[model samples]
Target: MLLTVSGPPGSGKSTAAAALATALDYEHVSGGDVFRELAEERGMSLGEFNALAEEDDTIDRDLDRRLREISETRDEVVLESRLSGWMAAEHADLRIWLDAPLDVRAERIAAREEKPVEQAREETVTRAESEALRYREYYGIEIDDLSIYDAVLNTARWGPAETTELLVALAESYDPQTDEGTFPVSGVRYEF
Candidate 1:
């Protein structure tokens, strides 16, 4: 089964995805890894690369293209990114969108990055806005839309371990043989 785990920064997406992947014996592929690779390739900071990505559309396209390929061809894999649900499309057996309140997310991010909460909060907000705009312009995707997801989880309500258990239960209970339906993605142009 292909599982898509998507969420904003500091929302415990990476943590949950890692745990879910291990619990289910599935490989985890993250867009963040690719993004970091792109950044390192350019000899630039993440902030600088993010700014460049906003101006140069290909950066995001390249990242999405790789993840999409993995999703389209792989099974028993966990695909994770802010837009992983959409990137996985019909190939995903379970599409999950995890999120938390901005304040909670900022605090989590602060601890992980060893940064100040206020600084994390401001950067998180700015990055989200920038990525939302890029997603809209590049693929006609509205980050606010949740209709495509099978599960929408608020990570603030649970710690990473609890969230992983919940996801494992959700996946174990899913029976593709008696599947209801997979909402088809349409209208958007996938140039990647």
Candidate 2:
């Protein structure tokens, strides 16, 4: 069973994915970390890496192929990425969308990157815009769409462990044969 977790930056997608994967004895794959490592190896910034991705279809295709192959072999796998839902497609047994408020995300990113809140907020907005545009231009995908997901979760009200537990429960209760599913939100339901 492949579980694909996606969300905007600092939304706790990676944290929840790791914890859920560990609890379920699944292999965890983080696309953002992979891209960051690639960027470092190439001595380029994330913006430059994203520009390269826009120009190079091979990079995205290769990663998608590798992820699909992994899904084929692994019984339990947790795929954490902004575009994993689109890339993994049929390979993912359940697609999860994790979200948090903009202010909360900005704070998280600032703390994680050791940057000022103002700078982190600017960078987050820039990166999110670049990612959204790049993904659409390169793969014709909109990362914010939730219709493709089995469960949509908000992490602003819950920590990593609690969010992971909720995801695991949802995964266990999911019936691939049925269209019914559960979406965990803090207060309101988003149409997308």
Candidate 3:
């Protein structure tokens, strides 16, 4: 099974994906990890790298290409990234968008990075705008659209363990044989 987990910054996508992959005994691939590695290798901050990407599309393109390659060839994998849902839509068995309110997400970021909540909020918004602009200009993708996701969950409502347990259960219970069926969301299944 190929599962793609996507959401905005500090939405716990990477953590959730890793937990889900572990529960399912799947390989976990994180696009953010790759992006961060590149930034570190170049001896630059994430903000600097993101700014450079705005000028040079190659940075985003290269990372996206690597994600596509993994999705195309791999099975039993969990791919996590902001655009992973869009990139792995065709190959993914489940495309999940895990997010929370901007403030909640920002708070999580602040806690994780040990920065002030206000500072984290500003950085998150700036990074999101930068990526959104580039994604639109380069790929014609509207990142805000949730139509592609099979499941959408609010990470702020649950801790990592609970979220992982819920997702693992959902993945196991999903019936792939039912083509063009509805997905359960907050106890209500909505048909497409």
Task: Note the Cα lDDT for every prediction shown.
Answer: 0.87, 0.80, 0.88
TM-score of each predicted structure versus truth? 0.92, 0.85, 0.92
lDDT of 1 by residue, 1-192 (tens): 999999899888899999999999999998987898889999998788999999999899989998899998998999999988998896898888898999999999899889999999999999999999999999999998988888888988887888898888778877766664322233221110
Kindly list the per-residue Cα lDDT of model 2 for residues 42-156, writing each as its tens digit.
9998778777877787777666677667666776789988888877886787888999988999999999988899888888898888778877876788877788876787899
Deviation in angstroms for 102 in model 2?
1.3
lDDT of 3: 0.88
In model 1, the number of clashes is 0
- The regions of model 3 sitting more than 4 angstroms off are 175-192
TM-score of model number 1: 0.92
Error of 2 at 93 (Å): 1.0
Q: Rank the candidates by lDDT, best first.
A: 3, 1, 2
lDDT of 2: 0.80
Model 3: clashing residue pairs? none
- For 77-151, candidate 3 gives per-residue lDDT tens digits of 999999998888788878888999999998889999999999999999999999999999988999998888878
